[model samples]
Target: MYRYDEFDATLVAERVAQFRGQVNRRLSGELTEDQFKPLRLMNGVYLQLHAYMLRVAIPYGTLTSQKMRKLAHIARKYDKGYGHLTTRQNIQFNWPALVDVPDILDELAEVEMHAIQTSGNCIRNTTSDQYAGATAEEVEDPRPYAEMIRQWSTFHPEFSYLPRKFKIAVTAADRDRAAVKFHDIGLRIHKNDAGEVGFEVYVGGGLGRTPFVGPTIREFLPKEYLLSYLEAILRVYNQQGRRDNKFKARIKILVNSEGVDGFANLVETEWNQIKNSGVDLPREEIDRIHAYFASPKFENLSGESKTHKAKIAEDKEFARWARTNLAEHKTSGYSIVNISVKPIGGIPGDISDIQMEAVADIAERFSFDEMCVTHEQNLVLPHVKKDDLFAVWSALKAVDLATANIGLVSDIIACPGLDYCSLANTRSIPIAQRIAERFSDFQKQEDLGELKIKISGCINACGHHHAGHIGILGVDKKGEEFYQITLGGSGAEDAAIGEIAGRGFSSDQVVDAVEKLVDYYKNNRQDKERFLDTYRRLGAQPFKEALYDAA
Candidate 1:
């Protein structure tokens, strides 16, 4: 919800002009692909398998109807008719022409959006919980802090080139909807016994070839000192993180090499040196940023709406959607509504231009003219009144966006794998679609209960498979596409990496294997237990047997 100031507008405008020149130079044959690669990446352009992909940053996953409309227009006129919402809460235009990228960026700049820091080895977009201001269970909305970090990290001279691409996530709630545990730097804003707001910081957590839950580097970092402490962590990683090999360049790798205690000690030493050296955001700037995020004015409706209850009683489809896709709102008579982009066999994170416009219109009319993109690749209307849920549901269904499968088996997180990415060994979207279709039944998915199925094309873990209750990683087995399954991983407060079940499955056998695991969970789970709980209690052995013995 932060608006661009003069400085922001000027900076973005200047960058667009600069990139336009660069693109012209490339088209004129003054630069080769190798020469132009880093330059384009700096502007969030990627050379995918078939075409150039343009990733636009959605800082902290916040969007306005105006911005959404701009995005839909871009999708319609510039690239394909759709955009892919990524796991990092950014949107990717997958089929843009190289020649038209500058024009695309110009359109983006019109909406106060850009692609800076969305790619490259620098600090990428800082993601936060989608329900930042609307949720009831947060200590404070973490978006302002995330915005503060975004401003600080945009083009910091020292960290412009990190050892690897770095990620940071912020969350204010006990339930980790932002997957903070899997980020390089994860900050949970909370209050101590005295009720002073501060961040519980974790460092070196990431998912990829090597996945690990970050260790708590600081138990309680004072709210004002957040920036300084974060700089300290990045400073240590910049100085110590491996750079010789891209595979081992992540901060998590460095943290694992040095013991957690030793790593924390290094960060502490760095902090002692720079904690008060004027590195923190100015107090006025902090207040200015916080002011933009002031809560929306709400009517004095103090209780739940009878209209909502009546609708749920009358409409089973609406009721089903309410059960899975809605979160408790901090304000009475309001709900945080999730718009799942995943249908029965649809691509996981894709939305057509028409769908985008429809959701934008829905957000504008029903919500407070605000929309959000979740880290799990879904849209959100963060402040919808409960009374409007039925209308919203009806509109969404008409646009084919009403999928009552948030957090269910069909609500999967999958990356565009071999179909798009040049780095993938196997296709992921098809697998995700197949798996979703396999468990397409809404009642059956509800029976399965809170199962997370994540599929990544490669070890890079773009889909965050390592953090799923059922994680599937695609790999090349000779010439065939094989999936390695892992169980019990989570991105919640009780974060843990999933353990691998023995032997990879071919694409043909993968869905059946997943079904077998679900079946075993259904049969063996204790009263009302979820897949993760059952897997944790019994370990991966039972699931492993279920998958392979049946095969």
Candidate 2:
């Protein structure tokens, strides 16, 4: 994790002071709702369907024990007893009073965290692969570049207000876990034949009313010109991106309108002037930022853990968990343990204050006092010893956190839908709860094998429904909640968008619809094909027939 420097601390403190005055003015009635809308939004405060919601940034989804404890404190003091981890890997408190927002910001500043640029059409939080620093397959840690971009885009005077919200993701690994292709700007970091680091930049990818898989604008942008290249792309979009209709204002639409060739030409023309400007990254500066993410110390241990094998042999439940929850770490004896937050029938990403504290304790005890938040919305202790599996699982089970459903049918990615979100047309949490309850049988879930079920309240794809093997989108039809299902989508090395199966189902029928789809895949799939492979080979037509057979 990148520790806040003096400049970072000073800027956040100043923003807190500035927002305090803004909150005071709004409450004093000096600023009406109309007048306060933009101000509050800029500060990441929203007057949602109910009370105000505050989204606090968890930059690149990395958290310290201190920071996680601070979040627990904020949850207990400000709104509710829980905080919802969002699709972007940030956390949101759904029920905060507007008057106490400045105080919340003050509390956040205590931990060197804030809500700046988290909302209001500005460049949002820069997201990277949640497993950035720990994954065994990574070429390098991508967080330093993410941190640099975060600072540069925080309040870039030029892009503070744009046609629509802009998102950027960087991944240094060969596999794309950050959903980079679905971002406004996606940077794939690589080293050229000359052993020089650079990025392959993709632009105009986004998911909203208009979803697009971004196109490559620059095949290889040198490391020094990364920021400048980004500036050029945004500069082109900010000036010429549509503003007439909010629906068509995204950079995706702009790129589509101009065609990839025309857009590339525009960016090239703009980049030529700014490539070697003040923003050009120096080698020393990149190395300095990279220093913060250096790997933790590890003991020299053998390839396999005899203790771990013994534990797995002793406990079947532990074996199941170990199989699903543990990921390979770069080090020989260390493992990346994903402490499942999705207990059966529990909210997908809601971690209570006690759980938060427990996680902090575990991070300090088991990990090197570090944790990472997964894109699937799970907490990760990145450097757990292979020998500590049982101890970690035992501690996690005590807190009701050990649910062996990682990558299984019950391991769903869901948003805090209509229940908390004003923008939602229907409830997503209850739907997710229903699905979990339906697949209550762990044996059945394990038999069904690796299946991803993602739910979203709206078409914004916050739940990443577009990338799920089984995608569920909730819509409201004449005051009744309905859900639409899509299959075959994936967010992995072989990424592909999901295709809708058929007509939408009522809330009650949605779970049954999902169950039917799984059954069909089970009966039709080849020997070891996952649900995605089955759907791809069979296509939506077969699934569509099966889904709407009796309709």
Off by over 4 Å in 2: 193-195
**Residue lDDT tens for model 1, 168-269:** 999999999998888899999999999899999999899988899998988898999988998999999999888899999999998899998999999999
TM-score of each: 0.99, 0.98
- Model 2 gets an lDDT of 0.87
lDDT by residue (tens digit), candidate 2, 141-161: 889999999988998999999
Residue 19 accuracy (lDDT) in model 2: 86
What's the distance in Å from true for residue 246, model 1? 0.7
How accurate locally is residue 155 in candidate 1, as Cα lDDT from 0 to 100? 84
